[model samples]
Target chain A: MLTLKQDHSTLIVLSVLADGPSYGYAISKAIAAKSDGHFKLTASGMYPLLTKLEKQGLVTTSWEEVKAEGADPDATGRRRKWYTLSPKGHKQLAKHIEANRQMQALLDAFVAPAVNDQNAHA
Target chain B: MKHTHGNTPKPKPPTSRDGIETWLDVLTSMLSLPSSQRTQVRDELEDHLRSRVDDLLVLGKSEAEAIRTAISELGETAQLARHISSASRTPKSFRRFAMNATFFVLAGSVLTASVSMMIPTHTNTTLPGATEAIVVETAEVTEPIRHRFNHEREPVVDVLQSIATAYGLSFRFSDGVRKSPFGKTILDTQLNTFKGEYTLKEAIDAFQARMYMTYGETVLAMTENELILMTLEEHKRMQIEIQAYQIPSWAESDDDQRNYGFSIEQLISTKHDLEYTTIQPVNGSLVVAAPPEVHAEIISMAAQLEAIGKSMQAQKTQQRIEQHAQMTRRIDRLRAEYEAAKSVYFAEREKANEFSNRIDELRSRRLFVRSNDELSKEQQEALQTQINNLGEQSKQQEITTDEAKARFERLQSILIDAESELILSDINDALPIEGMNDSKDEMRTVSIMGTANMRSGIYQLPEAGKLTLARFLMAADVQDPNGKVLLQRGGVSEPIGTVGDISSGTIDSIVLLPDDQVVITAAD
Candidate 1:
């Protein structure tokens, strides 16, 4: 799970983040849940990346008070600062998506007919 | 595939001034991170950590354990930092290149280009305040152009200080930090003396004696145990003085004016001592006998001693449990054996007694009937046999009683010895440190130039007190060549002699104390 290629990791993160802006915890959980118990991030690994993105101004932040139902009114609100990708982040995402699409097309053009011919022979 | 890689989530910036130094050391050592990158890395790491910790707490982990587990995942700080750097252009990622301690990364086209771009051209460099502009090239380290600037010109910023006039020139020396130059000199001398091969007391005394000679005619200086009065008045708080238990009087006493470490028991003794009560300018040479409790208080000082005594208390409690178990078994076994032997011996003796009584009754009846001469020979022989049986059983019971008594005495001796061993160990540990931890407060000393003379009169008599201890000493214990006695009496110690003292004779590192003296122990 850990030794996945860096490009594969980038794809996974983009897919998870596309749903909504989430803080470090929710985002990490989104990745794990979407992968169905395939991957997780250590705090050390995830936090630095979040900070780097914020530093790059590719993500913006907002604090939200998310209260659970039947919770004590006096208890501290589930206030968390959420992080979402900015316009620049979206543009960068689009470029990567295009590159991935081109790679996929190349693979389909070169290897699809060959794989089909082999299957037919069998 | 758009991933923000270099983002390290640090906890919100720690707002404590206290943790700066400690955290600096921790972070530097942990990451082996360069000084320049420290702040950014630390801030970012801290912010991310806080959020993650908050996340963990939400995820059902304890705040403490979550923080611990979160820190654990950092996975050898250096590697994680490198990975984070690859994700972004954070300075922590660029640390290796900045310090010029990088591997030959010829493959890094981007890094190579950036390095080339960073080196400034020589045309921009010039010497300050020189008519002939000296354009020095930093690119080539082949030549040197030393600037004629006064390197020692006082720093441009005096804005951080409130300057004051002292002696004549404007000075920033803290007058509040030192009451008198005499104290400053004494402490300075003491510190200097302790900086090398010197004992603590020797340093104190040598500096003190120098002070005595210098300021001999000034205010009366207190000497040794007579240095200050230890009293309950000093103990404003019930803080335990565990470091060999020497409570500074300045901290304890309401009279914080006097600055010196006050011995807690020494203070207690001052309050209890009649000498302190009678300490007025007396008319005669009064030999006042201090109360007997003075000795007991001194002895009781063993309680104030911390680490060693606490360990003894814990160890003795353990021993008591063990002794109780063993003693219970021994007593039970002895009692069982003795009871069995005793019952058999006594029962046989009882039968002999019954036979003897019958014989005596028969003889009495013969006498009453006036037929004393017609006694049967078989009856007389049977009475004799019963008398012999009675003697044997009595002897057997005596043996049983002696055997039981002997076993009881053996158990008693063992218990006594065990208890004694515990007491001795604790006692050896309780020897008061002569002067390693002196007072942190000020003493009003009359000064002669730079030396602090503590004696009221010139070279006043040092109040001698005996310090007897039971360490297995074969000399070589003290740092000085004082033949183990150090200094017997009024001799002035070596000038500025303060660092060395009675070192461990090391009758083995340590051992347990007896249960009885667990309340007061010296076993370190």
Candidate 2:
């Protein structure tokens, strides 16, 4: 599996949250599923990115208690933090997509010659 | 989707299984964040771990194996902690570059300089003066410059000029020496005593020594990046300075004030020509008049003396504190000994009282038997033997009581001295409590052989103490103990006793004390 760099990982996470609000585990699953098992974002990478995004005001977070079955109603259960993309985050994601597209076009200019040579040889 | 929460939710408490909990504990301990943030991060990670573990469990993995797989997916705990810490502290900008030693990238504004040498003359005429403007160009060399000069036969003047050119130095000769010189003096000298890697200072010193041996009246003076060969008499005419150095407070007494000047004079005279220097005691300070270089040496010497004074004061204070602590430890040891002896004394006294009571009772019984005339003679004789046996036991008890009393009195006397003791008191019976743990703190080797479950080799006890057979077996992780255990002590060939199952109650109670060897073999 390919490990994503910080900027790419941030762009992916922000793109995932653009659809709707989601928690850390669900976002990780979405990244893996969306990339078809080719990409993995572990909990270590997931929560810190979420925290940095929250600090930057690109994402806002809220907590919900996830009580286990047959657990005490009065007892506080495990907390699940949900991160939602802000309006600023939507703009940031748009900028990232445009930047990524420009980078790919510039890289393809260099790579196309090698491909054409391989095809000619074949 | 977000659910409404009235208050902040508490973190998930640790469960009994604790596999995931232990991982979180280690991960959180490495995070140098605020407690609230650490807790939030821990809870968030714990939730992620639980969700992953559940997913793995659904795919037919055991709870323990699922936890392990989930943890492995998170990568190394330390690396994860580092990432989280770096992220939370603030996003950082990183730059990376590489350079080979042969090539270095200089900044655009920096001008590189290369140095080239020019040797013009063999005579010491037109030497560079104090106001001479020397425009030097320095080149950056990655490696150290090594000098090697092997001359079978050469003029000293030519060799000196070569050294001056190679090391970028200029030379001057005093007027007296210039006038008295004659004939081309050919000498053989090996100036590279340090092979090839000698520093500039060592090379100059080596050449100076050779000059001194050849011309005993002349000395080489090196200062301010220049070398001067002059007779010892002419060196005193150079630049001189007079400075007043206030002696440190500890050496301000009359005798020390008188002697401090001589000490400084003695120190600098060995290395430099101190013929023009004079030291006089003036109002608790040394008024010294010497050359500028000698004055620099004197200032350095004064600083060193001040440091020595402070160090001596510190040492005295440290010695006092150590002496006080030694006295305190001795007192504590004496107190423990006194308490032990007191206990022993009381126990012996109680035993002696019991013996006395039993003897008295036996005497009363004998008197009653004598009063009852119908009693048989054999029964009376048996009663008499029992009374005699009780009397002998009482005598032994008295001896033990005396010994216990003596020990108690010895400790009491030491304790009395400890009350007035400014120093450590010498107490005879200063045994530690339990009287065995002192040796137990030392490491000792315990050899094991012919073991069915455990490896047959010398296993060192983590400590030197009375280790029981059961505890040793438990520590060694020996299982299926259906064997006979034998112990040997003091290098004895004969086995002491055959111990039964180490897991059982009665036989496992046997102690495997310090320096003992045990052999466990299967019952055939």
Clashes of 2: 1
Taking the tens digit of each residue's C-alpha lDDT, what string does model 1 give over A36-81?
Answer: 5456554345655565567767677665544333445565434455
- Report residue B21 deviation for candidate 1 (angstroms): 13
lDDT of 1 by residue, B1-524 (tens): 23343343333322222112222233332232344544545555554455555556455444444554555544444445444444444443232122222211111111111111211111211111223321111111112111121112222112101111100113232232235444354333321121222222232233334334442212211111111111122211111111111232223443331222234334655567433222111121111122223323432453345346556656755775475456446655665655665566556556655655765775566465446555577766665676566656656655665665565556556644554443333333323222221111232111111112111111111111112222211111222212222121223322211112222333222211111010111112
Which ranges of candidate 1 are over 4 A from the true structure? Answer: A1-11, A40-57, A60-82, A110-122, B1-25, B28-65, B82-97, B100-524
DockQ of 2: 0.10
lDDT of 2 by residue, B1-524 (tens): 55442232333232333457655654665565656877888888888887776666455454555666777767666556656755664321100000010111111121111100001111111111212211111112123344676554465666666665555567676566676552123233333332233434445555655554455455455433455665555655543445566665557578898788888888888998777888888776677777655666765565577568667756755675576578768878998999999999999999999999988998888888789876799988898898899889999999999999999999999876774453112111111111112213356667677656754566554321234566555444444456666677787744433333455666436555457877776666
TM-score of chain A of each: 0.71, 0.90
Q: What's the CA error at residue B37 for candidate 1, in Å?
A: 7.7
Clashing pairs in 2: B440-B464
